[model samples]
Target: MTQEEEKKKQRTRNLVVGGILFALVILFYLITVVKMTGTGA
Candidate 1:
């Protein structure tokens, strides 16, 4: 409930969200590559 604790919590949340977004981007990139190569069929 302290200011420092709040900042730490916010930073952790931001990192987790950023990581999820990054993983989704990589997943989409891989899917696109597979589809373009006609290997997904």
Candidate 2:
């Protein structure tokens, strides 16, 4: 692939990975909060 194409692919990969990580963090944070508060009864 050309240099430009390679750069674009790398950028896309980074964005996807970053998005997944952000989602995971948010999910974990929510889980922690729920655990701390406890379920109803």
**Quick one: best TM-score, which candidate?**
1
* Cα-based TM-score, every candidate: 0.95, 0.91
lDDT of 2 by residue, 1-41 (tens): 89999999999999999999999999999888888899624
In candidate 2, stretches whose alpha carbon ends up further than 4 angstroms from where it belongs are: none
Candidate 2, position 19, lDDT: 100
Number of colliding residue pairs in each model:
0, 0
Worst 10 residues of 1 by lDDT: 32-41
Error of 2 at 2 (Å): 0.4
**Model 1: CA > 4 A from native:** none
User: Clashing residue pairs in candidate 1, if any?
Assistant: none
Cα lDDT for residue 17, candidate 2:
100
Candidate 2 local lDDT, residue 18: 100
